[model samples]
Target chain A: MRDPFRSICDDDLERRWIWISLILAFAMGGLLGLYAVASNIHPPSNVETIDSSRLHLTEEFAEDKLGVKQNDDGSLTVTMVAARYGFFPPVIEVPSNTPVKFRIASADVLHGVHVPFTNATAMIVPGYISEINTSFPTAGKYSFLCNEYCGLGHDSMWSRLIVVPESTQGK
Target chain B: MNYSKAASLGLANMWVAFTFFAFAALLGLYQVIERIDLIPALKSPEMYFGSVSTHGVLMGFVLTTFFVAGFGYYTATTSLKQDVWNRPLAWFGFLLSLSGVLMAAVPLLTGNASVLYTFYPPLMAHPAFYIGATLLVVGSWAWCLEMVMMLATWKKANPGETVPLAMYGTTTNAILWFITSLGVTSELLFQLIPWSLGLIDTVDVGLARTLFSWTLHAIVYFWLIPAYIVLYTLVPRAAGGMIFSDHMGRVAFIMLLVFSVPIGFHHLYMDPFHAAGWKFLHMTGTFMVAVPTLLTGFTIIASLEVAGRLRGGKGLFGWIGALPWNNPLVLAAGLALLMLTFGGFGGMINASYAMNTMVHNTQWVTGHFHLIFAGTTVIMYFAAAYYLWPKMTGNALYSTRLALTQLWLWFIGMLVLTLPWHQLGLAGQPRRISSTPYDEELVQSWLPAEFAMIAGGVILFTSALMLVFILLKTHGNSQSVENPEVEYAESLHSTQRMPHLMNSFGFWVALIVVYMVASYGYPILQFFLLDTYGTVPWSI
Candidate 1:
């Protein structure tokens, strides 16, 4: 009221709007920060990089080894290769109620995989490795598919994940 | 009036922008139909990918770049009442950019560059595409130079004068463009061109993505600034009211420049090339950028409220009704703000550190951008054209009724097109796919919403055609308006005794430089320091 020439924030409406905007921004930051902390409760975070071109020759991602492996610690690690049109071992069987880690590498180009309606998703970029960890609580067959456009045959780039009851795991 | 050069420049560039917009709208229609498998004849993967890629490139690059540059030239001349600094150099830039666009079109149309608008590596495009894209950006650099020089020249002649708000926003956009484009230009010149030309055997995909992310998000703000400029400078006057605050305009522009450039890592949230910590850091910065947009929404609305109230409006919400719906720019500003609200909400969901996984590369992402870019941003471009076209040609608009009709159609059409997209994405449909060859049963659930989207696309295409038709008819119209001088709205508050920070570019520009290095410097360097490997290109 004293000085209209100084700044517009002196106006009541402007001040209220500024406060509202700042509060919304801070609320957003806070929510994202909270998500960051909560989601990190899982032990592993993926910064792992492997030679994408040599995945087939590697001991870890060799064709024979590209499926579910029951670790001594009881967690399952699924090593897979995402090439142009398909994931290696196209089908994998895992036990429900067990934590599983997927270490996927793109043999060529860029690819993304997602098990729809679930968070088992990652971008499979060549020259780097993608690792995602989660547990399937319900026993069922999930259509795992590549969501990114890697090539012309990208539509065919899909696989199946079968999560069996933990009681039937040995069979 | 000595604005003949400015008018000619604006007309030429805007026509090019709209021409591409019309073509892209047709491709957009085809894309939706193709995606839904609505037309069996459009099932060819080659054509589908080619059309999608072209649609993205044309709308994102060709339309936005040309339109912004055109809008900026007219704004600078009109607002500052100064001659363009260098007419010959300016035209040269326009030609160079046009030639570059034409060169890139060949491969894109032929499906040889189906990598989409993103210059992602490990999947390469024809070398001509990269080279042509580089030339286009380089040519725009000439405009950037001219903008800088023009503003500097104007300031020198009148030392104490605050830069006219319209030109102020334009020059800021120019500087923003220069800084942000460097990221992608470097990626194209050093990494993509060499590989596409076969001068190199393999390219590191990580580094390529990290670099592209540098340009990815910021470029949207660059496209968006012109729209905001129209809102800040043109809309209030168009609605018959004073601007709420010119200082808020400067603050928002500076914030857009400073925060937008450094926060691009939000695009790389899912990509493993960057660390999660870096992505989170960028996510925070992403939210920071929204502050400007929020402020913008308030200021623009306040200005319109003032207009409505000044026209004898009373009570709390009565002003909204009092505002002229016949005035194309006012109606557009109202609609643009509405879409921005929807689009901005979707952006918040996408920017959340964790929620992005659900929508990343999904139809939700696609819908979000279409609303923001096509709905919120492009609608304003339409208003600017309607407002500027008549002035540029010294003719009355062919039909104000048709102009209002076109704006209404575009608004309704965009809502129809994008709202269903969020539904499809929520149902777990991915983006950029030519067809859904999923489990027939799962896809069955997606068909209804997708069919709705195709309808939306058709509406948008028709509206786009109407726009081109209206502009063309206006060009040939015999009637002329009495006053053709450009008029930006005056502020409710006096702009004198301004803060030193708000008046000058030095502090903000320097702050952006430091912010960029701090945000992007080490994340890019990590690829080299780590055991990163280059991969051979994979062509479809």
Candidate 2:
């Protein structure tokens, strides 16, 4: 009986193409994984937690300590709180060519910090502190925003990241 | 017991599915218009979110569940050459789901449950919404049980026979959905319902997100499987060719079942509750799931290539032009693969641990999902409906020309819609927002893409209405014409017998259980073991 649905057997060339495509796909995946690890471009591991309901009362997230500060170790630490409609310290200034650690936490629900055109991004959960290390190579103004859907204000939930020249680092 | 009865059962379910689909499509158009600030009347935030939530649930949960259940019944009856095991029980499931939909619709339409389908807590909805959603899921479990039992009964009666490819795929999806849904079910029963009812003052947001992530990603697979089924079993025959390999199709289904469930944590890559280590593990599994999709692409394309070659086409790629472009199924499969290739690349970026940070929660994520779900999967659903409508109704289609035109319009509209979404995401636009009036400068840059998206939405909405019109016309057509029975593709090499592992789900099910436990065990346990704080529920 003739079956209309049956097809001709795959030729050697077609089989070769299939294997090549599969291998290339897997290899690309492996390479991407390797680059992520080797470059240390991943979600930060400076694991810490805070009481969400009492964030304002905490010393670490006190209004006085909410902007860029020069740490004792000569590195800069930017501490900010992501809240209902905006990020605390809505505008931050950082020195170009200097490694900075962004210590961000959410005051209420889940939020995400995503800086466009750079790999400086992390989730800001209410209780957890997300810390990512990065350096801006060029001096320019960049905007970062809360990417996760928080509430009605999610679309306008944004902050500015102002990177200054390295020569004026202290300013 | 007869063919007509089985067809009627499937047709009834599909009718409900298409109705929800039409409603959701209209809501989608309104959402785009609202976001663009094109209409003052549609500018209310409460109503915008309500429409968004309803659109997501209707398209994601209601339409997919009903359509898959209906398609599964039809495939099982026709392929196995047996009536559904319990016909009345199946109808009961249908009615139960429809009632659940109506219950959910009340709060959704009233703007009380505008938590936008993800329903991630701290933000809570009405108690009735949770109860209604629970009922819908429970009703679907009935369909799952029916599919599994039907396959088992068929196997017992036809001992030593391999399950037909179509039936085998339907059964695999049934098992996949059963396991995939447990996460959401646990979340609803233990947390959301209690919190919504004011029984629990506080809910652990971390734990809630963790449970949801379990169901979040794998559910996409549940939606895609029916499309894959149509591609493997029906498209080949419709194209006048066989499945490239029966064994390969089974391998793809099994791989999807095993790999899809354990990788749900990929959705949580941006969520802080899960450690980065667990996220990495899930990312690896996500990459593994891509293998089955690749295998599927090769098999289906190879089948099409053979069909084209057999039609007297010459040269290396000349066979493509020789195949039946007039056939809706063939055209849909071809377009679906094209969308899958582009969408699959975006998915890879989302799966990568570091890269996800760039696009997570952005409009890029929205673009990726719409391409896969609305473009690849829903297009096939349309094709399958077009193919089966004639068989089910015992009448000729109202217009093949209209059907083909609608398919092309859907493809073009989807590309036009989603490509700009990816661009807007890169331009720093966040999703699930009613408007983007933030910085004049930044919002200005997004204007062109937003306009393009509005145009795309108009095309899609028009195409959606056209589809409903065609189906309605075909069902109501008075023209009497001969109707052909549904025909599934044969395999290139027929199998009289197969190994137990390939033929049966026993081993696979056991293996999947082990894998899921390993992947999800510790991450979930830490929430309870550690002193985790819960925030008081806040409702709209």
Candidate 3:
């Protein structure tokens, strides 16, 4: 009997499958690339590191300077610290219809912050800063949730994000 | 060669794996109910997180590592037509790994290691937990050595003859594991163990996480490869046909090995440490691993297509219907492939850098993994056990009917449970929460999904118990088979004279080393160069 194992079309079929699969995979990659580059929005990947132990002593994340402050560039910078059980500057008050840039860092361990039903999310790893930029279109009350499992009180690790009207910023 | 020695060893390892699996499954059921906060008596955060940690460890590490090593031993011996290269070492490895499991279990079961299976530090576990985990991986290294040595010995004796695909896969996995495990073992040895033991006062969190990401993603592929091996080598024959493409299977296995190791930075996409360039690099590499999965899907379906047509089915869709559904292995492939389809879709979303934000660290991540690991991967583990039990035990299975029923329940349980979790994740439910005591409206909205998950959990627990019962009954089964050792499906074509690149490992290993250095070199090195602060361990 001829070696039936020496059959045709097995490699041929597989070669074609490889091409098709590769094409399919790259197409998805291309689409995601286009969305990332074209839309210019993505998960925060800024590589800024800060000594978390000295976060309160730092100029950028100083305890006195925490929470939303108007930048010289006419944008809002919300500097918050993610400690074990809660976010620092516990309830943030930001003006809606303005660009808000968050500079979050973990004071202890690791934590993640996510604004529900929005693309505003980041993992706050210790020894680094989480810088995410977003804008709230309308005045509303939202929450900054600790999404990562930090410690025992992670269940209650949430604070209010009260987005008030731009005119009511001082209030 | 006394193959029964390999069989007995495999059986012993498998029983230990199932014991952990059953306990973990019960924890899984408790977790679903606990998170719902329905029964006030079950509302303890410490208990909940401890259960979650133990559940993840038992299911993810203890069950998979034990089962894969056991199955590999069986495959190595039978496919190579040789006894294990060092039987005493194999037994020694088994005992060491088991001891590690027990040692780790002490901390995990007692709420001291509620860090979850990810073991994110400076969230400290008991020193024993880290030590035990290290010992477990180290023990598995012994099996890896045995696998490589046995295959090398066989090749030397055979001289340019094709390596059997099953043995090829087992060896590839062994080598893949040796490479894959280096990252975690380093993390354990250099950082976690020392920090937990008070040898080191603090740890660089960014550096620790970067080291972990190296092992995190590939470890999933480690759990998954044994299932793929069974699919490529055994399922087609059980369904009444040969492998549609044996050569493709080898290439697929190689791709899984090479691509899986370097792409783990995708897990760190949402984190603050890595910059955009490196994350983007890992994301693309992550997408590259998907190709092998697609290839495996095509090859297996094609093989089944042949089997169905050989059994007198016709047309594009008719063959699916004609498959030997009564056969447990065949039924499993059908269900496993179906789950893989959905799980693969979820994986693509996770791989895409932009889309990963939507599901990252949410219940969707949890759901996606359970579907792949529990739904696609573990189901196949069940089928492999069912298929191999009679051959290993010298007795026919007590009830094939019960086995079939068990599989369906597992499938149903996974879908019903995980589908709602995706919904909850989208609605902004974070993973690893002990309870949903959040905004009343938000908590209320998640109620229906939580209830559905509890139902799913009950069904899954029922299915798990059924699996354990069946295995136990099979051992005591009276009807014995004449030939306990059975040969399985052949590939459509011989792999002799395939390109040396396809068969060899040296080239692949070197390529992955270059790839890993390129992907991770700067990201990890920055910790030393930059003013990164280390932290002392934190108590929960």
Candidate 4:
């Protein structure tokens, strides 16, 4: 009588096929990881934290510097706040074809920043700052929405990213 | 072996599980319709969120728990050829869990606990909700203990014999649940309960989320292992073939237990509570866990191929056509593997550190989970029930044709429901929302998909009703029938001389503890160590 619980591990042909499948699967995974890293399409690594309750009173997130700003190094920095109902600076303007660093945090609860058409996304949690670096290649309107469920108003929590052409400087 | 007591207990638990499943399916249809804004009367965001929360808990917690317990009872009794070690204690567990479900249902239905299933603070639910959820977890722990004790007692009696594969798989899941559940147990007992009762002024949302992440991803496996067990133990025999590899089955089960628990930080990839380094570490673990699933797929397919070949299959792929497709268990397994392929790909994308940004928290995530959980896992549950119901009740199935129809409807409905959800996620539609009145142009593109989903939900709801009707009719029917018994798959080679590591779990349990500590210790401790800010509780 044959054992019903036996395996094909002992069969040479089947063993070879199993090895091939395992290797192919892992290789595919490896390639995807490599592409993500080489393309700079990954989660941000800049670790920064802040006091969530006092975000509005801070220097960087004060009423003046809460949106997009042209930095001294010819790069753009966009600072945004995610609250209960919507994102602060419901619309932001950045120059296309230039690197843009987004500095984001949640004022109340946990939210996520997802620019649907692009690879610029990160979590917005209270007491911690999330930063992502990416640049828009084309001048267009892109909508960034809260991906995490916050409350009843989570659906209404969205903002617009208007990437103007680099030729439209200081307009 | 007289299994009357065990069969009755199993029947009772499964009946409760199916009832909750039917209720949840109705709520699921209503949700899809409401999201499309088709009916004005069902358009309340308050009611919608309440229904969503209840739907999630009923399906995620109630149905899976009760069904797994019932399945475990039947598996233990049949596989080991012994009565359940502690019958009275099993009943106690069932009653306790049922009471917990009732306690939680009040707040969940009345909109007092509309925090969604995650129940992250500071969106607190009523204290009763937290207490009820706690009781439910505790009751499940009783089943865990019973499984482990049964295995231990059996091993002691038969000193050198290998434990049965079904019993081994059940015990593995039992240990995994005990460990996987501790995270949520701590969160409920310490943070949510205190804040909900006004005993605490503020709750640390960061800590709450961190702890929840510990349980979130692993709990999916707790729901899914039984499905996998059925695939390995029953599907092959049902198809008239032996399992291709019993050792591989043990290997897969062990890998699942070891790798699944420590990889949960991937759920927090978009959350701010954990550092990128920790998230990346967990991402690697998440990718590693996919190996066992891949192995299981290979083993099951190989088993089927062998079965087909034995049935006069010819050529390279002729085996596929030769195997039985009409049997519900075999058909469901085939459909399940199909869904697993697509769902597994989606999971890899979500688990990737960089690619996660593309679909994070979008309807893509929702679609991915539904494909895996509802499509792959629950379908197997239905197959297992269909296969087991007749045996447990000592009656013929009401209608094999209806069962087959129900299975096909579920598979088609799932594809219809989830495929568009993936597209909507790419189109910028956010999930967990009552309405998507965002950009009107973007929202317009999603309208077709939403309508299709409602149609799919209706099909699924009808299928759910049919399933319950068949089970009830089968139970009540008076037609005399042969007393059928469970027939587990056999292996081509003897498993009497298996390696010690494959035969025991003592080392695996110790390894899991060390791995969890290494992965989660610092991430959770930083909240207490640092002066993390807290938020006031906000209840509905």
Could you report the DockQ of all the candidates, in the order they appear? 0.56, 0.37, 0.62, 0.45
Report the lDDT tens digits of candidate 1 across residue range B1-540.
Answer: 589899999999999999999999999998898887877876888888888889988999999989988998888888888888999999999999999999999999889999989866787899989998998899899889988898999989988888888988998999999999998998998899999889999888888887888889989998999999999999999888989999999989988999998998777777767777788788889999999999999999999999999998999999999998799999999999999999999999988877777787889889999999999999999999999998899998899999899999899989998999998887778887888888777789998888889889988999999999999999998999667888889999888767777777998888998998899989888877988788888787
* Per-residue alpha-carbon lDDT of candidate 3 for residues B53-115, written as tens digits (9 for 90 to 100): 999889988999999989999988888898889999999999999999999999988899999
DockQ sort, best first? 3, 1, 4, 2
Candidate 2 per-residue lDDT, tens place, B317-395, comes to 9989989999999999999999999999999888888777778777999999999999999999999999988888877
- What pairs collide in candidate 2? A5-B241, A5-B242
Q: What is the per-residue lDDT of model 3 for residues A41-126, given as tens digits with 9 covering 90 to 100?
A: 66798888888888878988888988888878789889899997899988988888889899998888899988877778899998
lDDT of 4 by residue, B1-540 (tens): 677788898899999999999999999998998886778787788888999999999999999999999999998989998888898899999999999999999999989898888996777788889999999999998899999999988989888898888998999999999999999999998999988888887777778878888888888988989999999999999999999888788888998899899988888776656767787678777877887898889889989998999989999999999999989999999999999999998998898877787787889999999999999999999999989988888888888899999999999999999999999988877778888767778888899999889888999999999999989988986874465789999987688787778878999999999999999999888887876777777654
Q: For each candidate, what TM-score against the reference?
A: 0.97, 0.96, 0.97, 0.96
Better by lDDT, candidate 4 or 1: 1
Best by DockQ: 3
Error (Å) of candidate 4 at residue B288 is 1.3
Task: After the best TM-score superposition of candidate 3, give how far the Cα of residue B197 lies from its true spot, in angstroms.
Answer: 1.4
Best by lDDT: 3
Q: How good is chain A of candidate 2, measured by TM-score?
A: 0.82
Native interface contact recovery, all models: 0.54, 0.33, 0.73, 0.41
True contacts kept of 1: 0.54
What is the lDDT ranking, best to worst? Answer: 3, 1, 4, 2
